[model samples]
Target: MLGAIVGDIIGSAYEFNNTKRKEFHLFTPKSKFTDDTVMTLAVARWLCGDKEHRKETLVRHMQELGRRYPTAGYGGSFMRWLHNPEPQPYNSYGNGSAMRVSPVAFYAHSLQEALGLAKISAEVTHNHPEGIKGAQAIASSIYLARHGATKREIKSYAEEQFHYDLSPQLDDIRPTYSYDMSCQNTVPQALLAFLEGANFEDVIRIAVSLGGDSDTIAAMAGSIAQAFYGIPQNLASYCYALLTPYLRTILNKFEESIGVLTPDPFDIERFIKAQNDDNTYQQALKEILQGHKTSHWIWYIFPQLKGLGHSTYSQYYGLADTDEARTFLANPCLNERLREITNALLIYKDRNIERLMGSSIDALKLKSSMTLFDAISPNDIFSKVLDVFYDGKKDRNTLQIISKTFNGHISNN
Candidate 1:
């Protein structure tokens, strides 16, 4: 799956100290992987055993795995449930589902298969509806990336399926966005990062900077990014060199089982080789931008990209889409209720748009969003957008600079 170990380990130190800064020590004594890592490895190993038997033995093994990794930073209630001597789900709604669900997607080749394994993985501990939804959203994202989903399609899928509104305005979600132990908030927002990302690396940055349950959020976003971006050679090498040998070995074995011989030897050559099939989308994106630049929304939306095209830039510069011009519009006011918000997020996954133009995302808790308005195309967004300037004029100016910088990167690249 998508760098589950990397995600868990990276997030280990920052469960409470969520920050966008990338300068933190990766492996201090305080920096340790949590139950998320433990459970993910367990699932990866189990999938290497048998795919069809997933349902029959997943929960049994999960319970055992939880016991084996007892002090791996589990929730208090989860620990209590784990220690009960019998396997009874405490019915969690935590981000744990989103944390440890990469293998479900990796092992299952199809969407249906992926979701089935996701259901199994979730029910093992997080039997709540929200837990299942998070797992499914993350799992579906991984599966889609493997199938070659566009950035817009992936974000659209996640927002629709998980009820994420990727408005650059955190205020939309922040006032009600809390640290409660449920996958509903964490998974959806994490998906928001992945959906809006221009490439793989930014997915991690967006999730990391979004600031709630930072590690898992970044981890989940990173997983999908890896699936789509296929990991760069240099960064993958650094990640592998820093990872515990045991983890490196586990990943090697997992890759082997999936018919991939070299998993972590990512290098510039390998990245270039990997992109032998990438076509000229990056180039095309640059052409779209013209002169219109990216907004602050780009930072949280697109984290690790080098640039965009003028055409790509111009397309996204269009206004945000609103239903005011249409007759059959979605119910935006539904977000007044949490259930409506949650339900709207999940169902929206079905409308994976083929083309998205403009900066306008369907921020309302609606069931689906078709482009009524768009300020930019998907390829030009970036993470610098998370800066959160109070001055509206500066923010627009900043987005334009980012957009130009983005296009410049594509042209130069």
Candidate 2:
């Protein structure tokens, strides 16, 4: 998966320049992740979200991520499909389907499973027969490479199954190949590059030297190369450094969820420290108060502190003691809603915690257990104003004044 992202970034600069030689620097200042990396990460995220690998899940996640990154160099038709209120396959035969199917290889346990998942991954956008075939071929090659199949065996199987012409050498293909996006044209060349390369880097270089759709081809080849050669530590680190923190976090979570290796507790501590150092908590709180959506950093980080003893919570919040921390944690209404909001955010349900908080308050109106004022302790108007403010239905200044006054009352009580 990292290999595919690295390859995309490496080839991004040359995608338009059409370099036919492998002598170009692997990483340049202009290098960036494109649609290929985005969709690949989306697939990994979707897979991590559930135990079942359903087509609807793939479609939903892909569209969600796609909408998040509108200028990710997606094909025009595909972009339209992504934004459609009711998204359906547009019958694309483009290589976008194959470039993003790399994660299918890692998630499947058997060749049959890989092929089935590959089909499901592609048919959501690229349901054309050639598109489906291209994805299957790339995924099967990756599956075989990971399971220790030799290059000759992989080539033989791809040829027999997908009828891709893999006989041409890189030397022969480099001179004449031009930019092409069709799955039939690109997948075989990318596979050939993988089949002939000595290592992961060699595979990317060979794929780029073909000089057509450089990033997508290299991304396809890199996926196979990663399975066979395993990415070097230095290269993997370099690639990871190029990703945004959000993408890196998803990659880490996806890898962890898929049994790539349990994260070291020390590494997790380091991650927490990094988040704290970045003032992630302060930013999340500000966003909540200002009626903006906060990142999932809060959802992930708060849970670690939540279930710990009140002493730990006090330490986390710089409170004076366990009793002081309990002012917030001991409030059943607030605590229950916080848990629900955290779960919802983890699954990408509601982006705004403030909105979710307000919804929880509204739901209280229909419940017999308690009203918001009763839950928050006998401040009826204060509770209603808090709900309205958090829901973005009232003035910010009024909300702040009320919030401060309410906080003072709670503290005195």
Candidate 3:
């Protein structure tokens, strides 16, 4: 999915200025994300929210995101379709259907599901058989690649199912290939690029070297290449930095919804149980806590606290005046962790636990927000600290005693 966006941005500058050779700068000042990137994200957003796969839901989100970027190089007919008060399929067979359909491959649980969702995504505007077929072919190929299917298996499936000529070599087709918008002309060529490339970068080069519809072609090829080779961190980061905040948020939400962004519970538990020595435990806990502040692991261990909530659990040693907690809370990392924890708890649906976690995080945020210049209320601080750090056995008298202890500690510090 990230590879498709990267390919679109890299190839955007070269779309009009055709190049038959693969040798060129991968990115330039003129490079930008195009309609391919926009529609890909739109599809992802729709999939994230629409678990039921409703056609109306897909249409609404697609149009909403599409309208947000009206000048992102959408074709004339498609642009009109986006703006129409009541849009309908134009029976078009443009490769737009395939370019935006990559996310379906990752979102679907099975090949059949991928094909079905791809068809639904395309038919909103591209009701043409070729357009729908193009989407299904790309999505199915990606589905196979993701599930560890060999190139031979993918080639055989694509050829037999969609009747695309998968036998053409890139060398054979490169010399005469020209700009093409038809799915039949474009989709097979894009697949051939993926079949022939050595890596993700090579796939993009092969698609662009064909000298036709560079961005969309590379986008389709890169979509498959991503599933096969996986995207490089530097390239993925660069492409992500180019996206607007809204798009980035949607992308993160989609990834988390699919469990790609969330840490595996088994892995977390394994790490926790693997510790032996105090130093090893402290270091491991720090690393895990640092990596996933919003993780349920924090809550899993929260009720068994000994000292400062974040520091005591993360580090074996504790600091006075809750300096470590204050420092972490002031940084963006803590805020992100808070959001992640809050979201997880909300999804977990345990009202009592959610309320405790939410209130603790909110109090910590508020405490961090207060400045030294502001009048500090002991009661408020005491209540918040007690709420967060209290173990099961602490009564109000014990809590108040601990609070006074904290108050004295703060005054002295």
lDDT of 1 by residue, 1-413 (tens): 53655655566666687665544544333445567766787677778766565554766556676775566777887777666666666688898877889977887878998898888888877899888888998899899988988777877877777676655553355444445557867776777666666766656655655566777877787788778877655445534433333444566677788887762242223222322234332332332233222222321112111121123322222111111111111222211222222223233233331112133332210101111111222221111111111111222432443443332121110
Cα RMSD for predicted model 1: 21.8
Candidate 3 segments exceeding 4 Å error = 262-413
What TM-score, computed on C-alpha atoms, does each candidate reach? 0.58, 0.64, 0.65
Residues 6-92 of candidate 2 have per-residue lDDT tens digits of: 788788878988888878877654567888988999988887886688888888888887776666788889888888888898899
TM-score of 3: 0.65
Q: Rank the candidates by TM-score, best first.
A: 3, 2, 1
What range of 10 consecutive residues in model 2 has the weakest lDDT sum?
Answer: 364-373
Q: How accurate is candidate 3 locally (lDDT)?
A: 0.69
Candidate 3 structure quality by residue, lDDT tens digits, 207-298: 88888899999999999999999986646655654565467667778788777762321122222343323444344245333432332344
What local lDDT does model 2 show for residue 7?
84
How well does candidate 1 match the true structure in TM-score terms? Answer: 0.58
Off by more than 4 A, model 2: 262-413
Clashing pairs in 3: none
